[model samples]
Target chain A: MNTKQTNEMQIEFDSKSENEGFARVAVAAFLTQLNPTVEEVADVKTAVSEAVTNSIIHGYEKKRGKIFIRCIMQEDEIVVSISDKGKGIADIKKAMEPLFTTKPELERSGMGFAFMEAFMDQVDVISEVGIGTTVTMKKKIENSSTFRVSGDELNG
Target chain B: TGEVKRFLRDDGMIKVSRSLKEIANKVRITKDSLNGTLNREPTLEEIAQELNMEREDIVMALEAVGEVESLQKTIYQ
Candidate 1:
């Protein structure tokens, strides 16, 4: 078995509509150390924005609450988790369906989860009604020619 | 009936929807014939065609008319 190094960062902020951009940029900046490609940065930014926005609009329902974001950097992958203590989803399956929004009056479009799934390699959503919801996403950093080949060379 | 929050655009125009698609649909219109100069109300498609831009791009810009919270106000630990 091979042991891989890991690093983590966590942040908590109010569930305000405006923090969506902040959360997106902060996650992108943190991933900069990994030397991700432009597309990779954009993918993470969009995914983070969706998750944070969902927490603000759907979870907290615009009420005052707190949102937590955690990023874990593994050997060649990054894992991101966005969680909130707002009203949880009663049916996560229906919520994940594209164009299915609980708040249609707000014109939410219900594309948040779809965008997250499209941008990231893996997306896991866990929720319990009346409790809260958490979204966990992961993506492997590609275009890392330097580290990728070096790690393989040492093994060969 | 519950109250719906109305978000104002940068130019003081109230947006009806938060989704880009909805905004695009709402803004789409046929060429108007009010005057010889295209009725002065330019549709997004016409503007895109005239400016050599993508209609989707124009809709994306128009959808963000709502106020966005600044990052400086965020509380980080």
Candidate 2:
């Protein structure tokens, strides 16, 4: 349970949908130091994708702004924080509810927070009405010694 | 005659589907070639230009497929 921070990185990019893949891949690459399983990597990537997409589509409303991503790698876990300085969520409770989306017209399935919570060990959200929103997520990487015998266990 | 008119009427949707498939194929090929040339993952803009599509379109197409597949897996599991 040694939780000493080992490494960290910060990146700032425009809040554009095109950078969604970049943000996900960049965090996944930063996570290579932990030697995570393929499933672990995919999980982090999915969570990152969801969070970043939320920032771009919801936070900025497709307007130009800055999206910031910070990652801190501890001995056995990684914490990622994504923030955007745009219109923030008024009611986080409603926003986090599964299948609740303000932009149903955009075909948003409203599962972003749900997916983040599912894929990550923890998810935290802080927001202000007109200031911004920040989402922090953490996931613990299982050591190779105790790695599941079969990936099917996740689905089972 | 009815079938022909219906096909023509739905041409917009059919064209979008065909182009999406085409864009997805070209994205794969472009990614492979770009990975060799750049020795890393190419950005969406790179793939967009190579395929002669908008960056937004590329993002939409890629995410649409990925989200649907993952959503299905999550639901079934």
Candidate 3:
């Protein structure tokens, strides 16, 4: 579907750790038209990778499932949502807590949600025990022209 | 996800380049360490010296890994 407000793309693939890199690179590639800085692109990729990994490792628990990733570009911002139909987080708030992981034996590090929040301007996680989980993230890209003008003004 | 692309290394080995986040983790450092330094953001040379890596490697590895882990890893089990 197409909307006047934003350009959107949705992709669904098997839930696997190997696909994590793909998800991030695809999103970063789609964002190339915006000419984001390497840092900005890396930030988005890291966030995307974390969310996707959570869906694969935690949501499906290494089982076979489908991961849905949707990307929307609006004006000077990019919104990406990763969703999965698998065992959902029971306590989202606790899950978001840094270093709080249910699977410590797996060396999870339990910092997925924290990374998502730090990289994106906004992160919203919605989940239900048996239903599913969706992580929506939005990032505002600073326009180069505006940035240059502001820098010039400051110097002048 | 999309199509997969694979490339071989020059030494006939399959080399997988690590992400910046992974690189940062290997050094046991965070972006804040670099940001916390004096007047302005330090150059790649400065960061390389701090990390004990080559300037080129640091430049190539330079990226925003974001703050992944805020707390030290403790034995929870």
lDDT of 1 by residue, A20-86 (tens): 7668767876675565775577678778988998899889999999999999988778899999999
- Candidate 1 true-interface contact recovery: 0.00
Stretches off by above 4 angstroms in model 2 are A1-5, A144-156, B1-71
Clash count, predicted structure 1: 0
Runs in model 1 deviating more than 4 A are A145-156, B1-77
Scored against the true structure, residue A113 in model 3 reaches a CA lDDT of: 81
- Order the candidates by lDDT, highest first: 2, 1, 3
Candidate 3 lDDT over residue span A45-94, tens digit each: 87898899999989999999999999988767889999999999999999
Instruction: Compute DockQ for each candidate against the true complex.
Output: 0.03, 0.03, 0.06
Name every residue pair that clashes in candidate 2: none
Best candidate, TM-score-wise?
A: 2
Instruction: Judging by DockQ against the true structure, name the best candidate.
Output: 3
Query: Taking the tens digit of each residue's C-alpha lDDT, what string does model 2 give over A54-121?
Result: 98999999999999999998777889999999899999999999899998876548888988888899
Model 3 pairs whose backbones collide: none
lDDT of each: 0.70, 0.75, 0.70
lDDT, model 3, position B54 = 41
